[model samples]
Target: MVLCELKQQLDELLALSDGYAYCNQEVGRLACVQGQQEAELTALHTSIEAQNQKLLASTLARVQKEGAIRKGLEQHQQKLVAQDGQAEVLKQQLAASNLARESLSTTVTTALKKLALATSTQAQRVDSVEERLASLVERQRECEVQPPPGWATYLERNAVSLVALAVAVFTLGLNLLG
Candidate 1:
């Protein structure tokens, strides 16, 4: 009986040592799994930080592009305003030119009408002077053969006066024509 008890105790101690070794191996496997999980989490954090940096660079480039676009738009707006002002000035100049053209047309018309009236008056005066000159020439030719007397001298003086009047009339007609 004493030998049997001693064998049983030894078997129990061996079974306990086996249980402890199995528990220690399981603990070591659990520690390795936890280390792998930590490494994966660290890699994920590094990837997230790199993505954030890329996003920041992209955002800064977008902001700069937007600022340039805004400046370009402002410059375009200023050019449009200047063009509009120039257009208004051109419109005013056109209106003034049209008014000047109309005024010149009216002046030309008035001058033409006045010239026509003056031409007609000059024509009537020329006709009347020509008729009077024809009559005086006939009287002077009849007096050329008459005998000398006091009345004949007066008639000769009258012939000289008629010649002077004809010369005056011719000079006035030439002036009116020019």
Candidate 2:
């Protein structure tokens, strides 16, 4: 019964280990995805800032030109509108990414919690199994030192007598057959 329980506990521990491994893998994957999204967002922000700087420089240059000033103003307005649209799109993407990141974070936290619980349970089971095994080993050692009831007496008395009786019976049978 103890051995069966130990085997069951071992199986449970193996299953928990597998679950922990899977959770860790999922956490890594989510982290990678989050990092990639953050990098992309940073790149987009940098590009937008660079574009704004260029627009400001171009506007200043056009302000000094007499005939090109009005045309430049119109073009600048159009560029600003396009930039606004791009900013809105970026805002939407950022919001979406933020939501996704939050969701992934929650999932990772839950998985980590489950993994921790499973690990703790497995440790407790191992300790229990170890204790039981130790006790059984001690009992086995004690049994080896202590013989069972009448074992030595039975062996000593019966051994020689049984051998002599067998020898006599064999001799008698052989003489009769001859």
Task: Give the top-scoring candidate (lDDT).
Answer: 1
| lDDT for each residue of candidate 2 in 1-178, tens digit (9 for 90 to 100) | 4347546655665665576566556555655655665576567557656755665565455444423644544555566668865555555545665565567556556755755675576566556655655665565555456433343544464567557767878999999999
Q: Model 2 — which ten-residue stretch has the worst lDDT?
A: 62-71
Please give the range of 10 consecutive residues that has the lowest summed lDDT in model 1. Answer: 142-151
What stretches of model 2 exceed 4 Å from their correct place?
Answer: 1-82, 151-178
TM-score of 2: 0.38
Residue pairs with backbone atoms closer than 3 Å in model 1 (clashes): none
Cα error of candidate 1 at position 3, Å: 5.2
For 1-178, candidate 1 gives per-residue lDDT tens digits of 4347546655665665576566556555655655665576567557655755665575567557556655655565566567875555555545665565567556556755755675565556556555655554555444444433344444464566557667878999999998
For TM-score, the strongest prediction is: 1
TM per model?
0.41, 0.38
Off by over 4 Å in 1: 1-8, 84-178
